[model samples]
Target: MSGRDLLQTQLERGIAALGTSLPGGAVARLLDYQELLHRWNSAYNLTAVRDPAEMVTRHLLDSLAIIPFVEGATLADLGTGPGLPGIPLSIAAPEREVTMVDSNGKKVRFLREAIRSLKLTHAHAVQSRVEGVEGSFDCITARAFASLADMLGWGGHLLARNGVWLAMKGRHPAEELDGVPPGFRVEGIHLLNVPGLDAERHLVVIRREG
Candidate 1:
């Protein structure tokens, strides 16, 4: 099957799974997010997963699994390569503001285009290093962005008071968390079951306490 066809089938199945496993209304927005990603990915190298079915596992479902833990507040996706959790999360929660930041101009361009095409009024894209972007957010997300220490050094300032940092990791990140900077505490570690993908995923929630 063509990439588009495979993607559609996977989306249908994934959405069904989400509807059964998660809350309603989330699946439909995920579908819309997939469509937006596919359209922009054709022109920009936003994601390495060219096949739609792969995207369902790598992008859509993977992103949706984190929705339950995210507090309903403004979020900043640091080093938002290809808008992983940011784009999908924004689609799922249109009422919440999501700012996606990437150092690469091309990726930021694609993210901006996707937001405009989807008419995501709550989504914004910024092309700058995490440290350069000035603002506080209720939540800061990072997917394969960097080591925990690096993220804390650069993206820590962007987190609002009482905010949390959600970091997606593969395998147990015991070593990564061991060296976390001061003022941040590990709140919780959640094992995520990403549909259609056979991989160990963990969402580490870090909070700032001053």
Candidate 2:
């Protein structure tokens, strides 16, 4: 089978394995997103995962694994290198506002192009340090951005009072808890079962302490 077809097959199986359903045209859009990433990655070295099929599991599925926990209507993806969960989540939930922030110039350009090509009216990209981003969000996501404490130090102000911070980590971060800021606390730690991925994935759900 061709690359696109193979990616489609893997995407389908991965989504099902996550027990998630796609919105209308989500599969196509995601495939397009993956293809775009692949194309740019050739020259930009955007991601380490070079194969399209692996991108299905490592990128798309890994991003979607947190969809069930997404809350509210506004989201900010800090340090969104190539717009992982940000773009996919924006596509999946068309009504929500999704802003992707990255400090890198080339990645920001790629993100803007992807948003334009995808016609993601609800999504926008900002080229700035995570701490410098303006505005608040009902939900925030930081994927491999930094340790829980350090991320909050920089981007914590962007989370609305009642908002939740979903920090994607590769493993259970037991030691990282000690460094968590005084105002925020770990609400829950969810083990993410990304399809076709054997590595440990955890979503550290954090909230402001009352």
Clash count for each candidate, listed in order shown: 0, 0
The local lDDT score (0 to 100) that residue 35 gets in candidate 1 is: 73
TM-scores of the candidates are: 0.88, 0.97
Query: Per-residue lDDT tens digits of candidate 1, residues 39-105?
Result: 7788876787877667789888888788777884799998888788898888778889999999999
- Candidate 2 is scored at a TM of 0.97
Q: After the best TM-score superposition of candidate 1, give how far the Cα of residue 68 lies from its true spot, in angstroms.
A: 1.0
- Residues 1-210, model 2: lDDT tens digits: 987888889898888888988789999999999999999998998899998888888899999999998999899999999998899999889889999999999999999999999999999999999878999899999997788889999999999987899999998999999998888878999999998998999999998654
List per-prediction Cα lDDT, in the order shown.
Answer: 0.82, 0.91
Cα lDDT of candidate 2 equals 0.91
Q: Please provide the root mean square deviation of candidate 1 (C-alpha atoms, Å).
A: 2.7
Query: How many clashes does the backbone of model 1 have?
Result: 0
